[model samples]
Target: MERARKPTALATTPGLPPQPQVTLTDSNARLTATLPTGESIDILLHGATILSWKDAAGRENFWLSDAAKLDGSGAARGGIPIVFPVFGTSDGHGAEKLPQHGFARNSRWEFLGKSTSEAAKEGVKLDFGLSSQNLSDDVRAQWPYTFGLLYSVTLDRGSLNTTLVVTNDGDVPFEFQTLLHNYFRVDDIEKVTVKGFEDAPYVDKADQFKTKTQAGAVTFAGETDSVYTPAQGPGHPLVIEEDGKPRFRIVRDNLEDAVVFNPWVDKARSMGDFEPKDGWKKMLCVEPGSVSKWQTLEKGDAFEAAQTIYLV
Candidate 1:
């Protein structure tokens, strides 16, 4: 009998740069993207939450609480949590019965896989999907509308882009609100200032939801929960500066409202999942969304919005 032929190993082509990679870990519950330049991102299937984002130098760009639950027990306390359907508690408009921030942050999403594009600086984009059929009976009974959500997370050289597409799969129209609750890590919350909201009108949620206009760039003092509608319009870039130097710049597409929040001392200590009691001193939330009013989505129609955060 002739001897079996030996198998040969495949080799990578020379002179080409290393490609970006996407890895699934923790029994496929988490997806991580590593770029050729050493930048990386981690996302969980639960709520499709982005848990961590690191630069090429291995410095973390987002904050994740030490006490955050990663076992899918509850919404992670930090990082970027996606808010959909109803923002916070509903105020009538057909979503009053829905839970706070709706079900997107609490529901498990399906990983739709990843794709690469040279147009995005050879970056990799991961897609996630959540639909009405995937919802629990309790959640479905509360809203009773068939909808689909397509979330894309792209990791580029010096930026991260997140886009959401909401499709009305049912026969009736539905009103909803959406936002990206980004918990950004900072060296010192007191030294951080958020620009691009100057002269904008905002609602001070910490003060009985009073409406006020922002006089200057936002700074931290105590408990802060203000939602601003920028006069500069939807595509303007919001800059986060620390110690008079730019740290991160956020640009939103089709997302008009911005929310700045920090639980501060008292509220931070009250939250069971927020660690170290003083952990609030190291994080700030500069969220972009469409929360000033409910977005009405007609049947068979879709609405899309995106935000890109760049390191500075």
Candidate 2:
């Protein structure tokens, strides 16, 4: 059997800057990275949350709610929000309660600097690290497991490569779930078709978490929130397209499942953070994650997951 390689850095793309070309947005502290190819991406340092990603043509294709805050008071209403420690409101362990998606999406991470390798032939990658070392008492009180997390966001001409490396730095073992809550933009939600779920069983959140096997490609007609496990194989990448042209192509590694969601009319009205009740018509969140099973990491152990997104 072939040995699998452990992830230690960002996956290389064709062109990389000698160093990350970084700048801060004048309007907000969001950091922008411009690749040598002129493709660019924006990351808010507060949560290491991706705010915007532009394709080669400089056309932005990611979703951001008009009411989303760049100040980081809460998770930004859109783009790619990181989920860590716990996947949702309650971890079901009867422990102390946590916010909807844990604290990673709302906590500030340290900028560990950027690097590149001529031997590796990779693009400039930004490294952001988070440690419980400086977490406030309030944040630590909820789920106190010491950890070190390194998040790398790499910009490519047609794709964005994001990887999360989580290490258990505590004395005891810990269990957790994580997800990458990505909201992709579309001209019309109903018009887009998703491929790669066929024959896979899913937990339909709207149907009371009932498990059903996908008969074919998925399309949006009403509010949709479904979780599909072991979501890939020979079909490989998940493609979201309209009129047979690819919009977003998603590839995942070490991530075991996918969450497909759109809040639609009623849920959108109930969400105070979602701007404009009609915003649901233009976006969809096809998140890849490890929510199918909780990960138990022993002391000094590490876990990694990555998602590569291509926009055409």
Candidate 3:
């Protein structure tokens, strides 16, 4: 994994508010009722917590990280973070140009608008934006690309739907990898299994591009890493079953790849930020991403990907 260069500080937008100043701050992570539907969804970038995300019948649909057990101060690092152009790797080995996951997620994005109206369902929709104009010197020095990453999250109609549009606004074009990095809540990693794209080609990172498949209904017995390729078209639905029953189905459209990572033991012990045993069984990182040939965005051009998680 190449490290990105350390970023230098850039001047802030002349009239932007200081970081994390919400007009309605109950806490950094709190659920607010929206207009039409009146459904609430928990947001935890302040602390990886999701206090709400249930159905009308009150069924726990999404998986919550064990760290989600909030302390007196509420914050969890394991919830949802929009990973930009790159993930897990920088431009070099131990650079500060970009942090481990890039600047977009670490920077506090502005919540422009929100709604829970008829245009959507019982959940909420939030529109957030990040652009080169607002980036710090640190981010600019690392990649030197001017761009905007817009995220739209809607918990409506019994599904968690998100859309990310990466727009290149610099004088020159740029290329990079990305993922939604969704940490879906589940009952037990042991009790859960994923079904879809069995026999589909996958890249074995250890073998450096070797491809293989395990047929159908892949079960997570240990650490697993497979980059599912060419995941376009009317793709098969991915179902995560718990206790021999279907808990939820992840439905995607026009997606190119699925990065399935279940770092059961190794990831836990290695990362101090995560409680290995607590996280090992409660959630799965099923990312909808673009890699292989990095998704390129031309100046003023945009690329988009979206999906819905229907609670069953």
Top candidate on lDDT is 1
How many residue pairs clash in each candidate at the backbone level?
0, 1, 24
Candidate 2's residue-wise lDDT over 1-312, tens digit each? Answer: 765986688877887435447876745457888766667788887788988888657888788988887786788988898998777766475234678778888888777777762223435678898889757788888878899999988776677888999999989888888899999988898888999888888899898989899988989999899989744652288899886778888989888799999999999999988888899988999999888778999999999989989775
lDDT of 1 by residue, 228-262 (tens): 99999878899999999999999999999999999
For candidate 2, the TM-score is 0.89
Kindly report the root-mean-square deviation of model 3 from the true structure over all alpha carbons.
Answer: 15.5
Q: Which consecutive 10 residues in model 2 have the weakest lDDT in total?
A: 115-124
Clashing pairs in 1: none
| Model 3 clashes, total count | 24
lDDT of each: 0.93, 0.83, 0.64
Estimate the TM-score of every prediction. 0.94, 0.89, 0.78
Predicted candidate 3 versus true structure: per-residue lDDT over 1-312, tens digit per residue: 665987778977698322211233455434443323333466543321334465656655555454543442323445555566566666642233566656665665556677653444434577767777776676678878878877777766557777777898888888777666667677788887877766667886634657886577767777777778633332567777888898778777656777787777876667555664557777776776665456677778988887777776
RMSD of each: 4.5, 10.7, 15.5
Q: Could you give the candidate ranking by lDDT, starting with the highest?
A: 1, 2, 3
